[model samples]
Target: MRPMMSPPLLSPSPCSLLRFLRLCHAPRRRNPTAAPPTPYTFRRRPLLLLPVAMSSSASITAPNSVVADPSALARKVAAIRAAGPSKLQVIADFDGTLTRYWYDGARGQSSHGLLRQGNEEYDAKREALYEHYHPIEICPDIPLPEKAKLMEEWWEKTHGLLIEGGLTYEAIKKSVSDAAIAFRDGVVELFEYLEERDIPVLVFSAGLADIIEEVFRQKLHRSFKNIKVVSNRMVFNEEGRLVAFKGKTIHVLNKNEHALDMAAPVHDSLGDPNGSIDDYSLVKKRTNVLLLGDHIGDLGMSDGLNYENRIAVGFLNANIEKSLKDYSKAFDIVYLNDAPMRGVVELVSELCP
Candidate 1:
């Protein structure tokens, strides 16, 4: 943990910080239909500073990229640190955020991409869907609402394809076993730290919940009580076959805490107060947020909450030069070249120490 500076003079929370960061970042015409962006909400409170060592502060600086305003980033960090972990929650996008964008020499598979439904024709059809919609997903030209609708269409059609292909529970398990997906380096360390601290981590995703659970069971070897996943859930029949998805399709645009009620946590093995995603009473009280994601829209993952403070970290995995400016504007911190999660682990330490 790093040493904290003495509590700075307390001041009224700056509500316009979000607008200032966006406006000064890069000049762009605002979309009339798009929702305005949000920033870390600084709360006015009496705070106690913890005097700790400063050795690890250097580790928080990534060699890749960061938001242009270091002072703004510092202010958010200080506010969050002052509030401490008791008031904090971690909300992250699973694919490309928890998982790596690149592994070995090729692209890594997302929870959705790792599925194999056992029918060759169906597999081809699903790949076709990805080919068409993924481009639209990353395109900056489309309007936000229109893009959200397209994402819903993509997910709906893909789910229909899975059911049509006779997807079985056994098949999902096998697909996970055979998939090339892997977590980003240092992700386990971050999760372990959060688990030990009992800091709630909501793995919010636009992918399949079943596959994410399998990843935990097979890859991580255990489930953390402090963590819960909310994603598209598959309904399996008595014979253990996937019949349909349970609720409204969670697409990239709409993948936020708002979708928590539409689905259930896949790993409820904890079987206690913290096991279920449906019971978020504890989480609802933690208003300071630590948000992680790969897309510019991932910052919206905390949208459902009345957060008092939030530090958004974005992973710029691809199309670097093209999206870097916008990403820097939207996120408090941006890591490029698919950086490891070590920086985040260090960040959490500072906030919680």
Candidate 2:
């Protein structure tokens, strides 16, 4: 103050001064005996103290049929959905991925296995090959390189036996029709869905290509326009009897090496020297892949693709208990005990819809 003031009624200490200042600025408390104030006058609660309504019962729905990790699957599904169906491609193994592992409670036949039946000579050779190679193929402890060499030997011997058995085109047709080979549950629907969306399906198999085509033709009515069967094709003689296989053997291990070449378009009309037909260019643009397989080797199906995202679905139909961990490690999603493709179809629907 400009002038010295008279002594105060009481000389307050620093603590008392602080109290006086706080009392002057502080909000007034309601009288203990008085009724409570109206809603407008009531003090607001701190956000932290507010009661939040919590759900008593919560549920979580997974997208695919069986997934090793639900959160990872959700993130993958989200990425695929964001990309849409136009950018999506499906690479599936023909034998156990698209066809049922067992049909009518009996072990189903693969394209190669179809020939093993209905012929004594072929059956005997197949049994021998199985005795020698099947153990190696299924042995989890063995390294892949060693297993691959054994598989190549098995395929070469089996091919020679098939040729010696005089397997004709007519015989193949008959074998496919007679064998208990059937498409897996939801396979037809899966094809239909992919076809409707113009999504390409590459059936990459180590089995017989001719038989694979025949099966699709006879069973699914016809091979879809968007589907390409890439496998070991059988070469036939002028008389329509099996002469030899057309190209290098495609065993489980070497399937990925042929992916790029198989994806290349073979011009139907060499007459057009201008080479203007770019029919398959659209396929190259689809950089997201959905891979389905039963064996661990099937993971190589997408190896050569310039894919932005890949969702590997493993169908564990046999040795499930021992192989589940391995399948989960190798594949993003694993379906146990021959689970149908319904969940896969559902996931496709969400992505494409």
Candidate 3:
């Protein structure tokens, strides 16, 4: 068996590099109000870091990388590979998973965050809602049920604001034009590879379906026959004004395939009538899954299907210290510091080969 090469390293942002260099060179000045810095180390932790290279004949050799159970993971991979691409499907989270988490020293925007409602006041209110509920969304102390309920509330309120703000479809297009959003490196190649192999990929997001499709159309500039998007879709009026949202709300917790009943597939508008989220019975037969997501809750994306072999890849984009252990326990593989999708593409090549 050939050795698994390390994934490509991400280049540091120039602005961030300059800031770090200045801090290192400047004189040490103590501020009483500043909180003590959190200690971060890669050694001897239960969870490992990214670029974790593994070979069929060898165990995980990357010091910073972690696999919850190397032997078990290898077994799972072997099973899936034996089953081959015929039984494989990819389920991915849209926002931070497929898209870059950080870009140019700043956090990238989610599908929902790319909107500009044309009303400054309403936009401000939405930002305020994000500020309040985002912490609860990520708080490990909060019970899952409670957090889910809060997320439902936040989505409902935000959608209501969008309706009240007289949002237009034109605004949605303009938002995408103005937003600083980009897909992670290698995502396009992954999609292309899967498409070539006739493998179905379900992009399940709790974000706006229209926004996600726009990203594909405007940003990606190409559409795949095998990719389908399921999310909260907006119902537009004759004038293309946002009127209401279709189906039930899909919050962070209920974002799995189980919630497929609540939303319709977004691919029909792209001139394909075969793949509908409401009735994609064919996908259920593919009993091996490769799930990609940024949040630990994303593991549930496969809850609706009973897969004989499954691999869950988690992207630990932020608050690593607070969530790494839980992520390690939940996911088969966890990529740290918003690692690119090249590792995932490599994994697919291995599995589908």
TM-score of each: 0.80, 0.75, 0.82
Predict model 3's lDDT versus the native: 0.75
Better of 2 and 3 by lDDT: 3
Write down the worst ten-residue block by lDDT for model 1.
Answer: 45-54
Q: Where does model 1 exceed 4 Å of error?
A: 1-63, 263-279
Which has the greatest TM-score? 3
lDDT tens digits, residues 1-353, model 1? 11234346343245434432332232222212212222112142121111111213343222254556656566776677677777889999999899877665567889999998888999999999999999999887788889989999999999999998999988888999998888876788898898777788888899998889888888878667777788888889999988888877888888777777754454573244555433467787787889999997787788788777778988877776567668878888776666667677767876776
Give the per-residue lDDT of model 3 (tens digit) for 280-335. 67788888899999887787788888777788988877677778788888888776
* Per-model root-mean-square deviation over C-alphas: 11.1, 23.2, 11.4
Best-first order by lDDT: 3, 1, 2
The prediction achieving the highest lDDT against the true structure is: 3
Question: Could you tell me how far off, in angstroms, the CA of residue 313 lies in candidate 2 after the best superposition?
Answer: 0.6
Q: On residues 34-75, what C-alpha lDDT tens digit does candidate 2 reach at each position?
A: 122111111432111111111132431111123446445555
Report lDDT (CA) for all predictions: 0.73, 0.66, 0.75
